[model samples]
Target: MTDGVPTWEEIARDHGRFLYAVAYRLSGNDDEAQDLVQESLIRVRRGLERYEPGSLEGWLARIVTNVFLDEMRRRKRRPTDALPDDPERVLPAAPAADEVYVGLSDDIQAALSALPEEFRVPVVMCDVADQSYEQIAEALGVPVGTVRSRLHRGRKLLREMLSEHAA
Candidate 1:
């Protein structure tokens, strides 16, 4: 196995930064991005014994992608009180000062944020998160049936929300 620690460490040192960019896009913050990258390395390690040198980068990318998606699922599966329900939840938890004036029209991000965990996770995984249905199902530990249903419902809600503006 070619110096076990070096192989994994080498992989991480070489590719981890690139993967971290993808994680940050998925996670929306640096702290969570680093955590996801580190966790992705762990996952890649477990599968290393079966490593095919030809697809090493693909393998690493899959691990990074899955790790970020898994974090989204865990956040969704948590209790409702993961954040306070209060409207005045304050900045940081509330939108940042710049977001106060210069971000999305507020309504769209607000609508997305307001969606239930079941709908939100699937929607983000499909649209914004860009994870495949199979990947999403594996990360969320659910059937593909569940993923498709949730995605359909989530899209319908977003469509309705957007239509309100059209009307």
Candidate 2:
């Protein structure tokens, strides 16, 4: 056995469902859930050479968790304004006051997106990511108190948003 470890495909068949569950909770949607799991598997495969045999499952779990968070981080970034496929043509640049702002228009989506990054991060870490608050504290490089506060604030914000949206 290489490094005394089982093969990746074997372990994946055994554990893929568990990884999918983690992604499903974080994404709150089936399509994105599947994407998270697939991305996680890709990351695991990419880094396989560096993994220690004893840490196989742990490494895989971390990869899955990071993929979910990376999605959220990317969602927060401004989307590109350029249409990259047109290599031979270009449009005239707008004047000094023009700026493109692109994002979700629906109130519900906006509300979720508007939650403070700090609050949303801890809630997802503890709830959707299925990580212990202590683990979240370690991963976030923050005190447990900070994690607790963020989680509480996040839940409160969601409650308010949902109630408002339901009206």
Candidate 3:
């Protein structure tokens, strides 16, 4: 027990930035991401005592993801935001050759935000967060096959989105 907050609490506090990063990618909105992390903390506190030895970041990520999904299910619908017709208003000018990778990362993030939750969750866990397929399956309560399938499809979608931007 460090400072009376318990080991898990300390762990969560230490990894708060990582949690926020995962939440931001999943929710795609700063405020929604913040809310997800805040709400997940309650669940984390409850589950910490029983948490087995493994990746602490992965476990916290699972909790935050579940909380976000739960809230999404509760709402049953999300308000869609349409992009402006003006290209200038939507995207800035093209990047230089040296800055291509930087632009690619931004493009990928935008593409990721467009994916459905079914694909987004698995891809983020496997690709962005660097979790194994088995770990993602366990956290998502789905089979490893499902995780792989989702990841494959998600990557394909990302490639398509990126190519569209390139051309």
Residue 97 deviation, candidate 3, in Å? 26
The local lDDT score (0 to 100) that residue 4 gets in candidate 2 is 68
Residues 36-152, candidate 2: write the lDDT tens digits. Answer: 888887777677777777645445556766786776677657344333457643543342332222433244444645677677656756664567777777766789998898899
- Residue pairs clashing, model 2: none
Model 1 segments more than 4 A misplaced = 1-105
In candidate 3, position 154 carries an lDDT of 90
Please list the Cα RMSD from the true structure of every candidate, rounded to 1 decimal place: 6.3, 9.6, 6.5
Q: Highest TM-score among the candidates is held by which one?
A: 3
Q: What is the lDDT of residue 133 in candidate 3?
A: 88
Looking at candidate 2, what is the lDDT of residue 89?
36
Best by lDDT: 3
**Rank order (by lDDT, best first):** 3, 1, 2
Q: lDDT tens string, model 3, 71-106?
A: 777666633333446767555445456434565777
State candidate 1's TM-score: 0.49
Candidate 1 vs 3: which has more TM-score: 3
Report the lDDT tens digits of candidate 1 across residue range 61-109: 5677677666666767985634657665523455345435343445555
| Candidate 1 CA-lDDT value | 0.67
The Cα error of candidate 2 at residue 77, in Å, is: 2.5
lDDT: worst 10-residue window of model 2:
95-104
